[model samples]
Target: MEREIFPWIGASRGTSILISKKKSFHYTDVIANNSSRYIIVSGIPQHRKITLINIYAPNSGQLVGDPILLGGDMNLVNNPLLDRSSRPLPADAALSTALDELQRLLRVTDVW
Candidate 1:
């Protein structure tokens, strides 16, 4: 029997990033916390490098440099009236502030 291996990062419990065996790149750096996982890959066909982040935020974390893609459960809603149910819960003000700061610093836009 043979076993197939895939490149991955992060703890078993929290946030994680898994690279498919076919498209997995040569990663040079990794930063993982309770709420996020950062992986820096090299020799990305055309681009020199790209950073991939899997984040679950409002908790504290370190920021990564540019040419990156970030996605995860933000634990936030843009318009509670439209996005939430009948009993809408308010997002934590402090967390919202922090997330906003992160977005500004990263200069990235939400895709959806």
Candidate 2:
């Protein structure tokens, strides 16, 4: 599996890749820096290609359309603790915003 790392916001990142198997498939990993919100999208090769997305949202949402799976993480888990005592701490909101933007871009791109 070949991988490519595409950085969006500072420290917050996302990855896009092409996995070679019996058929070629595309994948994207969107990760936030401070939050536990990580979204993944996988595309299967077929006449009617299937797109599967694994999302961790700390809120409610719905899945729309075929070959698309939408989910949320209503409860916050796996999120690192904030260090207010430190010189500076990254904001979770920023990271969450970045991940959201990345997801939108990946969904529209043909490379996915």
Candidate 3:
């Protein structure tokens, strides 16, 4: 698939837009869009439409709604020792807690 850009105007740090696509990922109808900080989409599969949300969430992940695929650059680490670029840094308790909550919220494998 190729990128499509259209006339867009003022919005916040994140925005959601919708586009209709003929087919994608086993779905005959797909709708998707991206913003400065997130991407959101819905696909009609098996006669039902489900959503996937991609975000650059702030500290808390800010998860809402039930989504089939929830994705983002959450800046969280399941294993701090291995996730950093170089030397490991100490984990922030709050971020860890938030990430844990996000994990529980999604209830799925967190691998990319």
Candidate 4:
């Protein structure tokens, strides 16, 4: 099944998750906004819960679980010096700081 969340005004900006029916996982909760979507699912066999988050920008939120994975096009970079070829923008620096704090709070590792 294809799950999509579009902005209230239109579908110009949105995120989608395609789940196969044959998969042994089903979604239990979903939280979405104009720029982000969060889905919690449980594996049928192991009954392990997982939270998946997709984001388009910097948005603060929380999820509780042993393992959580996030995929996004956030404009923020972890290390500007290594990630960027030019000088870091002010806006990006702020967002990067916010992202760092969020990651620390969530105790999640950046796989970038």
> Which model scores highest in TM-score?
4
* Per-residue lDDT over 18-96 for candidate 2, one digit per residue giving the tens place of the 0 to 100 score: 3445565544333434443443454445544554433343333453443544554422212224423333335555664
Which 10-residue span in candidate 1 carries the lowest summed lDDT?
1-10
On lDDT, the candidate that comes out on top is 4
User: 102 in model 2: Cα distance from truth in Å?
Assistant: 29
Task: Quote the lDDT for 46 in model 4.
Answer: 40
Question: What residue pairs clash in candidate 1, if any at all?
Answer: none
lDDT of 1: 0.53
- How well is each residue in 1-94 modelled by candidate 1, as lDDT tens digits? 2221223533453455555555635666666543333333333523467766554433333434424566677777544566566655655555
| TM of each candidate vs. truth | 0.32, 0.23, 0.35, 0.38
Candidate 4 has what TM-score? 0.38
Misplaced by over 4 Å in model 3 are: 1-67, 91-93
Q: After superposition, how far is residue 85 of candidate 3 from its true place, in Å?
A: 3.2
Full-model lDDT for every candidate: 0.53, 0.42, 0.54, 0.59
Model 4 spans with C-alpha error above 4 angstroms: 1-67
* Candidate 4 lDDT score relative to the true structure: 0.59
All predictions: root-mean-square deviation over Cα? Answer: 14.6, 16.5, 14.3, 15.1
Candidates by TM-score, descending order: 4, 3, 1, 2
